[model samples]
Target: MPELTTRIGDLTMRSPVMLASGTVGYGPEYEGVIDFGATGAIVTKTITVEPREGNAPPRLVETPGGLLNAIGLENVGLERFLAEKLPEAAPLPVPIVASVAGTGAGQFAQLAAAVGERDEVAAIELNISCPNVERPRNPVWSDPVAVGEIVSAAREATGKTLSLKLSPNTSDILSVAEAAERAGADALTVANTLPGMRIDIERRRPALGNVTGGLSGRALMPVNLALVWKVAEHVSIPVIGSGGIGDTGDALEFLAAGAVAVQVGTALFATPEAPSEIADGLRNYMEENGFASIDELVGMAREERRTCAETA
Candidate 1:
C-alpha cells in the first residue's frame, strides 16, 4: 500500500484528509455518523475566550451550489473546552486540532498558551478569518499588520504547530499570507469562506438572520483553489486547503494546486462519510498511478504549469 502520511510543519498526520472546524461539533456530535480513523486530524469548532451564543436565528441558508452560514463561531468557552471537550476528544484515535479565535492579538496569545499546554491537543488553528462575527473590532486577517501581530503573539505562546486560517475577502491575499509566514506561522489554512448573501423575495429581507453569511461548498472550489495555489507557492509553510472539497476529485485538485492537506467541511453536513471515502479513493488512485506518497502528488499541477510556462 502507498504511504498516505502528510506533514504540516513538524506535525505529521496519518492521512491528508482532515475534518474542518465548525462542521463537527466538539467531536461527540458525530459519534455513530462517521469513522474518525479515516481522517488525519479533527479541528474543533472555533472556541473563544468566553462561550458564544452565536448569531440570531436562521443562521443557515441553502444556496444553489453552496451553503451560506452565519453561525458566528458558536462554541464552548475556553475553560469548558479545556475542562470537558478536550478530555472527551482525547479518546479518539486521530489528532485533535483546537480551533480558536480571540477578540484581539493578546487574547489570541492567552488562548494559545492555555490550549497548547494540553497534552491531548496536537495543534492550534487560528480562526482569524471568520466573517460571521458582529465585528466589534476589525478581523485580524483583514490587515497584514494585524495578521503579523496576532500570529507572532500566538507563536510565542504555543509550542504546538500553529496554522493560520486566512480569509479570501481581502484585497491582497498574497500579502496577508506572506505576513503570517513572516510572523512564525507553521502552516496556513488557505481560506475560510466567501462573504455572500441571498435575498428572500417573499419575506422582502435577507435569507440568513445575520443578513450576511459565509458561503461554502462546490461553488467555492475555483476561487479558493486559485488562492491555495497562489498562497502555497508564495509561502514556505505548509498550506492546508479548506473550501469546496466535496469528493476525492475535489481533494485531489487542492493537493495538485499545492496544498499539503485538504479539509472536508460542508460535505460532512450531508455525506458524513466523505472524508473516509475520499481518503480511500486517494489511496486507490495513488496505487494505480504508482505514486508512493502524498508529497509526490502535492503541487503536480503547479509543476506542470511551470513547465508549460517555460515551454511557452
Candidate 2:
C-alpha cells in the first residue's frame, strides 16, 4: 500500500485518516471489531479532573441524517486513566492520543500534566469544544483567549504533541484557530459538535436528559468542512478535519478543504469497521488518481470555487 503520508504539525502520521475522540471511547472499546493498529492514531475520550457519570438516560437520539448526544463529557478522570487505561493503551501498535477537557484553564493543565507525566501517552488531544461548561458562563473553548490560555498551560505541562479540538459553533472560528496557534498549539482539530436541542414534542419536553446535546454525523459535513477550510486557510498550523465524515469520499473532501488529516466520528456507532475500510478506500482512490501525498489535495476546491465566483 502506498503510504498516505501526512503530518499534523511536526509529528508525521502513517495515514491522513484517524479516529475522533468521544466516539471511539478509549480505543479499546472497538477492540472486538476492527484492528486498532490499522488506524493513523486513536484519540481517547475527553477526560476531566474527576469522573463524570455523563448525562442521564436516553443520551443518544438519531436524527434524519445525524445523531445528538448529551454524553455530558463522561470520563474516568485523568488520575484513574493514568493508573488504569494508559497501561492498557500504551502497548497498542498505533499511537495513543490522550484527550482531556476542563471547566477552566487550570483543570486542562492539570489533566495535561497528569497524562503527560506518563511515558505511554503519545500525544495530547485537548477537547476545547466540550459543552458541559457549567455555571452562568464557563465555556473554556468558546472564548479565544480562554482557548489560548488552556493551550499555553497544556504546552507548559507537556512536551507531547499538542492538539486543541475546536468547536465549529462559534462566531469566528478563524480567530479561535489563530488564538490556538499563537498560544503554541502544535495542531488544531477543526470542530467538536454543533449545539442543538432536541425536544420531544409529544411529551412537551426535551428529548435528551440534559435538554441539549452535541450534534454529529452526515448532517454536519458541510458545516465542518467550511470550518476546516476557513481555519486551515487562515492559519499555518495543521488542522484535523472531522464531523459527518463516514466514507472515503467525505475524507477526501476534508483533505481538499485544507485539512492535513481527517477524523471519522459518529459513523463508528453503526459501522465499527468504517475507519479501516475508509482508509483502504482512500488508498485506492489516491492510487487510481495518481496522487503521491495526501497534501496534494489541500485548498483544491477553494481555488476553483473562487475562480467560479469571480466569473459569476
Candidate 3:
C-alpha cells in the first residue's frame, strides 16, 4: 500500500481528509455512519463568544448544484462548547480542531486562549468571513492588516496551531492570503462560502430567513479552487482546500491546486462516510499512479501542464 500521510505544518494528518466546519455539525452527528477515527481531523462548526440562535425559518434552500444557508454561526458558544461539546467529542480517536469566530479582535483572542489551554484541541481556526455587526460597511478580512493583527494576537494566547479561514469573496485573494501568511498563520482553510442571496420568487421574499446566506456545494467549486490555487502559489503555509468538495476526484483536484489537504463539506448531508471513502480512493489513486505518498499529488497538475506546454 502507498503512503497516505499528509503534513499540515507541524501536524501530520493520517490522510488529507478532514470534515469542514459547519457541515459536520458538533462532530457527534455522524456517530453511527462514520468511523470518526478514520479521518485525520474533525473541525466543528464555527463557535462564538455567545450562543447564537441563528436565522429564522427557511434558512436552507436547495439550488441546482449547491446549498444556500444563513446559519449565522449558531452554536453552544465558547464556554458551553468547552464545558459540554468538547468533553463529549474530545474522546474521539482523531485530532479535533475547534472552529471559532469572534465579534472582534479581543473576543477572538480570548476565545483562542481558552481553547488553546485544552489538550484535546489540535488547533483553532479563526473564521474571518463572518459579517461584522460593528462594521457593516467594510469586511474585516479584506484588509491584510487586520488579518495580521488578529492572527498575531491569537498567537499570544495559544501555541496549538493558529489558522485563519479566509473568505473567497475578497477582491484579491492572494493579498488576503499573503497577509495571513505574513501574520504567522500555521495553516489556512481557503474559500469560505461567498456572500450570496437567492430570491424566493413565489413567496416574494428571500429564500433564507436571514435574506442572505452562504453558498456551498458544486456552485462553489470553480471559484473556490481558484482561490486555493492562488493561495497555494502565494502563501508558504499549509492550505486546506474546501468548498464543493464532493468526491475523491474533486478532492484530488484541490491537491493538484496546491492544497496540503481537502475538507469534505456539503457531501456530508447525503453521505456521512464520504470522507473515509475519499481517503480510500486517494490511497488507491496513489498506488495506481506509482506515487509513494498522497502528498506527492499536491501541485502535480501544475508541473504536468507546464511540461505539456513545454513539450508542445
Candidate 4:
C-alpha cells in the first residue's frame, strides 16, 4: 500500500483529503454518514467570537457549474465550540482543524489562542475570504499588509499549525500569500470561494438574500489548481488546495499542482461519501503508478515538465 500520510508543519494527516470548512458542519453531524478515519482532517465551520445567526434565508443557490452561498459564517461562537463542539469532535479518528474568522486582528488572535490550547485541535485555518462581512472596509486577504498583520497576531497566539485561507478576489494573490508566509504561517489554504451572484428573473431580485455570495463547485477546480501551482512555487510551507474537488482525479490535479493536501467542499451536497471514495481512488492511483508515497507525487508534474524543458 502507498503511504498516504502527509504533514503540515508539526501536524500530520493520515490522508491528504480534508473536509472543507462549512461543508461538513462542525464534525458530529456527519458521524454516521462518513468514516472519519478515512480522511486527513476535519475542518470545522468558521467560528466567531460570539454566536452568529448568519444571513437570512436564500443564502444558498445553485448555479450552472457551482453553488453560491452567503452563509455569513454562522457559528456557535468560541464558548459553545470549545464546550460543546470540540468535545464531540475530539474523539473522532482524524485531527480537528478549527476554522476561525474574525472582523479584526485582535479577535483572530484571541480565537487562535483559545483553540490552539486544546489538545484535540491539530491546526487552525483562518477564514479570511468570507464575502459576507465588510468590517475591515477592505477584505483582509485583499491587502498584503492586512494579511501580514492578522497572520502575525495569530502566530503569536498559537504554537499549533496555522494555515491562512486566501481569497481569489485579490489583485495579486502571490503577494498576499508571501506576506502570510513571512508573518509565520505554517501552511496556506490556496483559496476560499470566488465572488458571484444570481438572479431570479421571475421575481426580478437576487437569488441570494445577501445579494452577492461566494462560489464553489466544479467550476473552481481549474482556478484553484492555478493558485496551488503559483503559491507552491513561491512558498516553502505546505499548501492545501481548496475550492471545487469532486473526485480522485480532481484531488490528484491539486497534488500535481504542488498542493500537499486537498479540501473537498461543494461536492458534499451531492455525494456525501466523496471523501472516502477519493481516498480509495488515490491509493489505487498510487499503486498503479508505482508510487510508494504521496510525497513522490506532490508537484511531480512541475518537476517533470522542468526536466523535459531542460533536456529539450
TM-score list, all predictions: 0.96, 0.93, 0.95, 0.96
Candidate number with the higher TM-score (1 or 2): 1
**Candidate 1 lDDT, tens digit per residue, 2-121?**
999999876799999999999988887787787999899999999999999999979999988899999998988999999999999889878999999998899999999999999998
lDDT of 3 by residue, 1-312 (tens): 888788776677898999999987878777777767678889898888999887787778888899888787778998899999998887787888888888667887998999989988888889988642234566887988777788878877888887789988788878788877887789999879877788889989887888878889989998999898888888789899999998899999999998889888898887888888999899888888787887678887787655864686
Model 2 pairs in collision: none
Candidate 1: residue pairs that collide? none
| lDDT, residue 148, model 1 | 93
Candidate 2: stretches off by over 4 Å? 133-135, 304-312
lDDT tens per residue, model 4, 1-312 = 899999898888889999999999989898988878899998999999999999987999998889999998899999999999999988878899999998778999999999999999999999898888655667677899988999999999999999999998878999999999999999999889998999999999999999999999998889888989999999999999998999999999999898999999899889989999999999999999888887877897897655864586
Which residue pairs in model 4 clash with each other? none
Error of 2 at 224 (Å): 0.7
TM-score of 3: 0.95
**Stretches of candidate 4 exceeding 4 Å from the true structure:** 135-137, 304-312
How displaced is residue 159 in candidate 2, in Å? 1.2
Candidate scoring better on lDDT of 1 and 3: 1
Model 3 clash pairs are: none
Model 2, residue 302: distance off in Å is 3.4
As a TM-score, model 4 comes out at 0.96
